[model samples]
Target chain A: MAWTAPMIDEVTCGMEVNMYFPAED
Target chain B: MTGAAPAAEAPPIDGSARPFLPRGVRLKFCEVRKSWFLLAPERALKLDQTGVAVLQAVDGERDFDAITAHLAAAFNAPHDRIAADAGRFLAALIARRMVETA
Candidate 1:
């Protein structure tokens, strides 16, 4: 199934995402 | 940007579409098809028949239990692992705004 993914350019294809989770207060 | 963690990578979906369809772990809306689809991205590709099994398992809410069971059975893996993976996908899709929670 093909879909036109709606998102900001940086969040679009081929970008490496780095995530960091902070402590919950 | 302040101290907040960087945004995670996730898929995208229209918020307006949620009411018409309640998505689970594997299913996603196919805007062009006007239908829902099961996404098993290369990150977690299923074997051939498992693909078909995944498709059949997502009919609706009642189908979730069956779907979870099917996933465990098809992958020959532990239930917890299957559950975690499924949860991860669902959470990722939601975070990406690819699927909305209703």
Candidate 2:
């Protein structure tokens, strides 16, 4: 099989995460 | 207090260095994209099919030369060409902390 050189590209995306926490008194 | 971030150590790409993926870095196939990716913490790298093949050959036991030979044989390509390309690719990954050399 003929082969081509490998290439890598960075994938950049914005990510968001939601967290729930107990209230501190 | 905050300090300067540590520099990334340069990896050996002199054909004698053995390369491997570090902890928390993984090569995976994306069903949605139908492509391969190098997934690391907080980051992802899209890879072409050739990239997948090259990465699959990295076992940490194979030095750069061995890896090149394996790839060249499998692809029926020239060893020098594969060596040049694979060496550069691995070096890039090393700089990004996705791959390490032992």
The stretch of ten residues in a row with the least summed lDDT in candidate 2 chain B is: B1-10
Leading candidate by DockQ: 2
- The per-prediction CA RMSD against the true structure, in angstroms, equals 14.2, 8.5
lDDT of 2 by residue, B1-102 (tens): 112122223443888889999987888777767878787766777788777888999988999899999999999899998987777778778888898988
Q: Write the per-residue lDDT of candidate 1 for residues B1-102, one digit (tens) a residue.
A: 222122244443222222112332354343544444333321111122333344454454433445556677766777665544444443444554443443
Given the true complex, what DockQ would model 2 score? Answer: 0.29
Where in model 1 is the C-alpha error above 4 Å? A1-25, B1-56
Best by lDDT: 2
The count of residue-pair clashes in candidate 2 stands at 0
**What's the TM-score, to 2 decimals, of chain B in model 2?**
0.87
Q: Where is model 2 more than 4 Å wrong at Cα?
A: A16-25, B1-12
